[model samples]
Target chain A: MSNTTALPISALHERVEAIFRKAGLNAIQSGALARVITAGERDACKSHGIYRIEGTLRTVKAGKVKPDAVPELVLQEGSAIVRVNAKCGFANPAFELGVPALADRARACGLAALVINDCTHFSALWPEVEALTEQGLAGLVMCPSYSTVAPTGGNKPLLGTNPIAFGWPRMGKSPYVFDFATSVAARGEIELHRRAGKPLPEGWAIDADGNPTTDPEAALAGAMLPFGGHKGSAIGTMVELLAGIMIGDLTSPEVLEYLGTTTLAPPHGELILAFSPQAFSAGRPGDPFARAETLFEQIAGQGARLPSQRRYAARARSEAEGIVLTAAEIEQLDRLLALGLDAVS
Target chain B: MSNTTALPISALHERVEAIFRKAGLNAIQSGALARVITAGERDACKSHGIYRIEGTLRTVKAGKVKPDAVPELVLQEGSAIVRVNAKCGFANPAFELGVPALADRARACGLAALVINDCTHFSALWPEVEALTEQGLAGLVMCPSYSTVAPTGGNKPLLGTNPIAFGWPRMGKSPYVFDFATSVAARGEIELHRRAGKPLPEGWAIDADGNPTTDPEAALAGAMLPFGGHKGSAIGTMVELLAGIMIGDLTSPEVLEYLGTTTLAPPHGELILAFSPQAFSAGRPGDPFARAETLFEQIAGQGARLPSQRRYAARARSEAEGIVLTAAEIEQLDRLLALGLDAVS
Candidate 1:
């Protein structure tokens, strides 16, 4: 036996939505969360897909996150900056409500930013920025989550992995999406290595004493190192300034108290910035799209491909057939299914 | 002999200004170019300091750059997005006129962007971003210069080193700045390595055949690699879109035809984004400054230094004790000084 099973993409979304609803999320919350998870799976981000649902549900059960809390619009300046008060709930719902408006503002004003506060970020940041790119806008998003990283020179861990995601709308293809945590390897990747009994590549993490280590467990016990050394660390700090301090929200270090040891519902902040190319253009002959197409040709002529190009390829390939979950993964999902509806219990 | 000479900071600026004026630039153009070059030296950016003067002067002399052209404000949306047509001239002059207004607009509107098209960005990006931070605003500036580096997996050079610079306004202190070309090392660094006959670290560049090489000469003959592989490549692409494509200008490769074999005045675009934290803040009890102070403490506590911390340190040291320039650099500047004034000639 292959020891794997394939499920339809629609079934996956419905299952995720049902699970969120069963855990008592409101319709908007469940749908928003489900869409992101399904999209993540379709994009081949197994780290954030079906694998993350249990921990997300645990946040609802622990009473740390109010699953049905509707986000609030706290403040705005002109049409360029909008601040969303997430009311200590899932971030997807806030993005769902705020991003389209932010894109509209960007369309009108040339640029706009949506600063989200008091939100529990449940997964990767790609979906957040992709929303804007889908509407022919360029988008950049950053969020500072729980601290698990050390700054460049020190042994003490005082920063989060701090993922940043960006998307650029193309002429007719999928938007060029790029998303990554500032760390050399994500915490989940390291955890996977440990679970698989494999060692990590050098420079990924450190031991409890903060010396470099390839041992995933020891590195996890210590801290993740920022990618590209000081440059990545600086970007991480910038992320904190934008998503945390500028948004009047908790920075990675400041949010430590709110983080549960096992189940997490840390009320982090996310900052989304959108830009309209047409607004920046002077109505010139060689507009943005024409220039982008030239760049794409040049990039493709060389062996190097665009970021998230692989994701699009995987997505198309998987959608044609389906993705197969390993036996262990199936077991994890089955366990959640066995729990049934909390309302029934 | 030490082969180095120490000159007063004022002398450096005056010398640079004299060279520009001697080459037929107007007063504003001369002063703006001089200020940026002097600042590059004071800030210890040796690559762009006196070394870049001749190439800049050549642009003015060759008629590639309009030495006296005034950049026109072509378009603006609301108060947030300002697009400047650089009139086929030097960018510093345009930034000199546009940045303060852009900062004021950002202060009023919460976020603002200045998009410049048809200009030669001839100096370090730090000065441009620091302009906003000096006004107590956060700033990010990106520009696409001549193409030299390739995408991550490709050997063909399709993108510029593509510098990205950022600055954060600090309370009662020099603004924290971070600037780096999104490459394993800047092309300038590679040239320096070649001049010094030094070997490169791994993953820096690929030789003509697209195989990785540590030899500085081979690496220079080939294409430079992106910093942190694909993540940095994506950032490079994003910069091209924002600074080149979105601004309705030529992408890096598209501008390459105008570049001379030795001298460069490739007209490119620059994108400047500014954010006013005060505008985003709700005036809560714990203001943004307090959070920044707390963040500084955590950063210091963890023994991690902020980006551009070294530059500020360098500037302070250089200001106290005059910076020493190499004999070669002095010779280059002295050659221009020997030419005297164009009107006199």
Candidate 2:
């Protein structure tokens, strides 16, 4: 893992796209995958960015994920409920197609719910929700991952550190976004710590015997704790029910098969909700966008940092000065580039 | 405080109504107050039931709550957004009037949000959501109380252990209702332990210095832990933002001024959401009610207990025989009965 000098984001995206294209991804699919990976890095989500390249490539090679598959829309209930059978993975055509339709339905219905099943892994939710808000629609998205944590007081892991993201539209300011895993800490964080040979924070995980453990390896062998304890457990349970059971995918037992295991294969189910304030309100006669902006400004002034502020700030920095990547991560990118991968195709 | 023997449910309601009437509540207001209190006990929510009578009387006497106040409807948009101002106290009337209208709007708009502000405590949210489901609508309700618990890793209590309830209508069965407080344990549980001289459960509360304590009395002097830790905290925080700030109520700090130091009085904000399944689907042609019943039976067979099963069961028992009350609680009822209150009108 020798360090390599940083490269411009464009260069990185091109290289990543080229790699996917080399692996037989069509131009559109490669471009979509590259955009998602690059966005993760731009937002400082290193674990979800190029760090995932090796695993993703392995999945592609193993045929666990299709490189050029398109999502099929199964059911549409006008602006209320839309179901998309992700023929491939979540990040490719599934997200690209489902998001815009969800936004349109939200505009028509005031609130819209989209179910994405059998889709590939969606790395970061913020970009999707943020994109919705940018289109004047508030977004709430949740995805139940492979089970990696136990219910409170339960010895066996039964639920994923399910993540939820909410984005609120603003007028002049960036949309307010809140996104976090339902666990005390995401399993990815534990995995990262394990990679770096670091101990986990107290209360974040429990060992095989259900005793608290700081050793990332031990936690990986055991279960992560819920975020707030019972409340978090309840939410995790709710997510399992809503995002998993409700969407017709793996239940508690089935999800457990993927625990402590890493693969680029798509998780089975994800739920997305998009809402339009105008659908519920008399469309912003006085500029609702301005009102939203004022609300965020007021919240920030009151010492409350809006969720996603840090990510948005990072994105701005990346756009201005280019994305920052570790030398090692850059080397990995270089290796892929030298292999003649054309990400953008 | 001395223990009062239990009495029949009818007697308890009569006593509570008498107390409110004597305290200057109008007939309808007294009846509504009695209904909520009696329902709390009926549903096994002892904390929100008869226990709140004395506190309510004191607040009314002190002019802290308006006994005869009425909520004013402020705005209505396609039933998607309905706003109500709780003149001063009286949350019941607003709930009674606004919920049905919102449900109807949801029937038309697919989803609806009802925001109520500046109201005295509205106890036991399950009943309200159940009522919405009875009208064939799904409901999600959230209430953010005044600050009662500190944020995780923060000493000062900065947020309320907000509660949220969700109810979905089944095709043929009782609506699935899930109602829970965001705290590790309800505030009432702590009070119960304090009165009974019992140790609280581990992980339920933390002392003033943020150390876990099982001593109820010490916990009373300290802070309740968020349910699931950070996950529950996140939900509570979301409730505060959605039901409190977004709905235009005073923040936790301003709300604390109105609620007393004890767990007795809490100034809180409540938000109710209603969604119509019919709006999503024309639903099968005939027997919409029958469809719900069938759905419930199937779910029940699958080991899914309907939310608020206890309440429904108790209601059935009360309807067939009579509502049961503890001897001590009954004695308290008799004391109130001595005021010569009329059960109806």
**In lDDT terms, which candidate is top?**
1
Cα TM-score per model: 0.94, 0.78
Model 2's alpha-carbon lDDT is: 0.68
Across B1-345, the per-residue lDDT of candidate 1 in tens digits comes to 489888889999998898887777788888998999898899897777877777776666666788887788754547478777788878888887788778878887789998887888778899988888888899999998777788988997778888899888887888878899888898877888889899988898989888999998999778898888888888898988888888888777877766743246678889999998888776533688768878877887877777777778889988998877889888878778777333221
List model 2 lDDT by residue over A268-319, tens digit each: 6677777665644342233444544554444445344456667779888888
TM-score of chain B of 1: 0.92
What is the total number of backbone clashes in candidate 1? 0
Highest TM-score among the candidates is held by which one?
1
lDDT of 1 by residue, A1-345 (tens): 489877778887887887787677899889988999888888888878887787787777777788889998754546478777778888888888887778778888888899887888877888877788889999999988778888888776778888999988886798888899998888888989999999999999878797999999898889899898888888888888888888788888877656745246567788899988888875765768777877887898886777787788878977987766788877766666667344221
Model 1: CA > 4 A from native: A1-6, A74-77, A260-265, A322-345, B1-7, B75-79, B260-262, B283-285, B322-334, B340-345
Lowest-lDDT window of 10 residues in candidate 2 chain B? B280-289
For residue B34, model 2's alpha carbon misses the true position, in angstroms, by 3.0
Docking class of 2: incorrect
